[model samples]
Target: MEELLRFGIVGCGSVAAFHAQAIENTSGAVLTACCSGNPQKARTFAAAHGARAFDTLEELLAGPVDAVCLCTPSGLHARQALEAMAAGKHVVVEKPMSLTLEDADRVLAAARQTGRKVCVISQLRFQPAVQAVRQALDAGAFGRLVCANLSMNYYRSEAYYQAGGWRGTWAMDGGGALMNQGIHGVDLLRWLMGPVTSIRASVLTRAHAIEVEDTAAALLEFENGAVGTLTGSTACHPGYPRRLEICGTEGSIVLVEDALVRWDLPIPCPVPVGEGANSGAADPNAIGAAGHTLQIANFVDAVRNGTPLLVDAQQGRQALEVVLGVYASGRTGRTWHPETP
Candidate 1:
């Protein structure tokens, strides 16, 4: 019989519900406990998920959880992950891993020192269309990729930011549109197009009255000599579907909200077009738990069978480097060179 992988969650916020649902949906995975800054919120969350609740992360770490899923504020991820790994538990962290490259390095260092697994949530990679495109790219079907472009135009209202004290701050939520909402696309761009060698960018807070940039744009240079553009905004009216275009010498592909809308290659795509309908463009809650479920299931398999993680801590850090590079360039008006990962 397969042993159950006991899981605990930190942060009972809105995103934590998705983690709980994912854990519940995954085989050989159980949500045994949870913790949050608000004890009542933790208790309520745990009760809804049939789990125990703790008032603090330290108490949760002392319990019977084999792994910890960190759904806390962006700034808290690396510190909490390090604490969990040090306590002899594996970690599944939310996206961007950490706000800065230095903190991300610390988390990776701790994971290496503790010999514990760390998976970062970049769940769109699990989409069938995305997998097919990745396979095509890997097999040299794309033939010398030349250009990649990503558009992540999401919407978050003033009420959304005002509801959480930490939402728009640089210290907690990290950067606004790109780091908070567009990172999935950033990760996809990096994964599909390869390492980002350099970036030049501009950022501004145009919509909501927030501390971070609600709109951002960047020009990127990939390691393979591919030039790409990334534009992210929480101010786009009616919030259009996120789009990605990959162009190569042989063919080109287009994806809209995880769906492969265009396949210009000679061979047919393994998956049918427009299969995935999920999107978080206009509403964050609309993204659903399908991707989370797939990612958590993969994490369970890795923890049980010694399989490789789809998005490890190092890859998480690499993604963070791209976002941070944009921020640095925006602030300094210089071309930022990201370290090769």
Candidate 2:
């Protein structure tokens, strides 16, 4: 029998619950430890999850866990991930791995140096609908992809930003809606559509009185000559489901909230039939734990056997680059191309 993989969670926040639940659901994985900035909260979380609580990440790393899930603020991912890797532990870091490309690269470097596997949380890819789309794309079902668009209209009140002191700040939450909320779509888009060559964008803090943008739009040019648009806003009232539209010479696909709503293709590709995945359109906590569960299962398998991750540290950096590209274009009011590393 395979040895059980022990897991640790850092930063016991709203999202950490999802990680803990996912670990509980995955086979051959157990949550053994957790840490949080708030000692009492950590103790409470530990008691609820049947795990040990630590006052610091260092203490958690010194424990018996073989992996660490970083559910911390966006800004803390890179540093904490590096520390975990340095301690010979695998890492499952939350989205937008780091605020800067340099830091993302640093994390990647640490992963290589430490020979530790680093998985980034991009649970959307594990959706059955997304898998079907990817399979069709791979089989040339989407002939010569022409255009793709992503729309994320989410609503987070001013109180939401105020509740989390780092929510709207560039230092912690990174960019506002696009980085914090829209990155999942961004990564999914880039993964499906291919490498983006150039981008022109505009960002604004139209609704909230925050340091970062609540509304943003961008025009993208892909390496395959596909043109696309990306729009995200936390200010949009009566928040609507996030949508992704991918078009090609053969046909097009429209996915809303990770469900294949429309599938028009020349070939007979299996239509994904199921209930739509939960969306955090109006409330961040509305998202379900299924995707997280699948991802944690994959991470456990990857650690136990030598399987490759669906979203590795490098892919995480690619997503971060696209996000930074949007921010750069928003700042200069000109087209920006991702810098080659």
Candidate 3:
């Protein structure tokens, strides 16, 4: 039997429960300790998971744990990952790895310096449907892709943002719709379409009273000569599922909510039949824990065997760059490239 990799969960919020379940689900891991700013909540959560509760980060670091999974707010990820790595623990963090590309760089740098593995949670990439799409891209099934798009439109009730003080803040939650809600699709877009060259964007807070935009639209130019559009919104009512459309001279494919709803091609496409492995459609927290479990399983193998991760700390920055570029273009009312300041 493999040795157990004890894990400590930081930030005892709603997402922490997912990590806790993942830890329970994984074979060679255990939830040994949980930390939160609020000690009572930490204790409450800890009791349920049979973990020691600590209010402060320092205490958790000093505890008997081999790794730390950070479920903190957006703005806090970089700092927490850096500190945890400095304390000599492998780090796993939730998405939008950090609020800015610079912070993402710092987190990756810390991981490199410490010689510790850092896994950024981007489980959507592991979906069977998405894997089929990647295979199609690699096999040139699209025949020099002409256009691709990503749409992450869902409704978050006014109360959803109001429920948490850090829900919509620029300093913590990053941007509103694109950063918080639509980013999973943002990551998926970049992963599928390849590196983006330029983006012209328009953003606004159409529905909720928040510090950031609830809706954003962008024109994307890919490095591979593919032009595309992206729309991310939390203001759209009836809470629609995410959709992605990709077309080429040869054929096209459409994925609704990560499921391969439409597949059109002349070539022999060995596409997977049935629903996708992800259901992160309308409700943010409604998705299954299988993705998290798979990623955690991979992270453990990486930690034990020095294997590489598909979504490393460095790769996590790409999606964030796309998002920041959109926000920057929205600010200047001009097209933005990552190379541009």
Each candidate structure's count of clashing pairs: 0, 0, 0
Cα lDDT tens digits, model 3, 72-162, are 8888999989889999999999988999888888988888799989988888887777788888888888898999888888889888898
* lDDT score, candidate 2: 0.92
Model 1 pairs in collision: none
- Model 1 CA RMSD to the hidden true structure, in angstroms: 1.1
TM per model? Answer: 0.98, 0.98, 0.96
Cα lDDT of model 2 by residue, 1-341, tens digit: 88889999999999999999999999999999999999898999999999999999999999989999999999999999999998999999999899998899899999888889899999999988899999989989888989998999999988888987889998899899999999999999999988999999999989999999999999999998999999999999979889999999999989998798888977664766544748899998989899999999999888889789999999998888998999999999999997765
Q: In angstroms, how far off is 206's CA in candidate 3?
A: 0.7
> Per-residue lDDT for 61-102 in model 1, tens only?
999899999999998998999999999999999987998888
Q: Model 1 misses residue 273 by how many Å?
A: 0.5
For each candidate in the order shown, give its overall lDDT on alpha carbons. 0.92, 0.92, 0.88
- Give the least accurate 10-residue stretch of model 3, judged by summed lDDT: 273-282
TM-score: model 2 vs. ground truth? 0.98
Which of candidates 2 and 3 reaches a greater lDDT? 2
| Inter-residue clash pairs, candidate 3 | none
